[model samples]
Target: MEESKAGDLFAEGVVKHYEPELKKVEKQLNELTSKQSSLLKELQKENVKFSSIDITELTSLYQMMKEYHCRLIAMKKDILAAAERSEKLKNRAMKLKEYKQNIALENAHYREAQMKREQDLIGKPGQPL
Candidate 1:
């Protein structure tokens, strides 16, 4: 029981810390999504411009576009990883809560059993369990 209580406390602390960080990551993901959309549109526009322009300058621009695409992919990957970590923390917190509940229930059952044993031994008022 004590161990479970301590685990509950630790899980709560971890969950408390993780919640705000998860929100921050969510916000960052939103911002990154918007940025990615805008960049994609810009890349499309650049492609259109490239189609009409000379090849000499497009090489550098193409490199820049490729770099931008890579960055967007990396940001998406980071967001996925953050989401996974957040889910793990949430699951841990829920399990801790369940553990605490189970411990309390088991303690109650034990106490009830002890009471029953005492009643059986005492034989209440000429009666027995």
Candidate 2:
């Protein structure tokens, strides 16, 4: 119960903490993809063949693209790790809840038996034991 709530809250907080960072990474990847597409389109319009392009002129762009790709891969790994953590937390919370319910049910059965025994001793509110 309470433990589960606390665990869930903590998990949510962790997710929230990383959400913005994930979004920023995704935005950067999108921008890079768009830039790459536009660059390719411009080359096509100019009838520039890949072999005819100056490697030196495009070296920086290539480096930047590679860096962005690496960052994207790192971000993906982070997101996967976060998802695994969240799943583990959820399983823990569920187990805690199930254990709490089982304990409550056992307590209820015990209380019921106790009440029955007391009623039997009292002889059902009658005159005899």
List candidate 1 segments past 4 Å from native: 1-57, 119-129
* TM match of model 1 to true structure: 0.44
How many residue pairs clash (N, CA or C atoms closer than 3 angstroms) in each of the candidate models, in the order given?
0, 0
Residue 4 of model 1, lDDT score: 100
In candidate 1, what are the lDDT values of residues 54-122, reduced to their tens digit?
786788889999999999999999999999999999999999999999999999999999999998788
Badly placed stretches (over 4 Å) of model 2 are: 1-56
lDDT string, candidate 2, 89-124, tens digits: 999999999999999999999999999999887786
**Quality of model 1 by C-alpha lDDT:** 0.96
Clashing pairs in 2: none
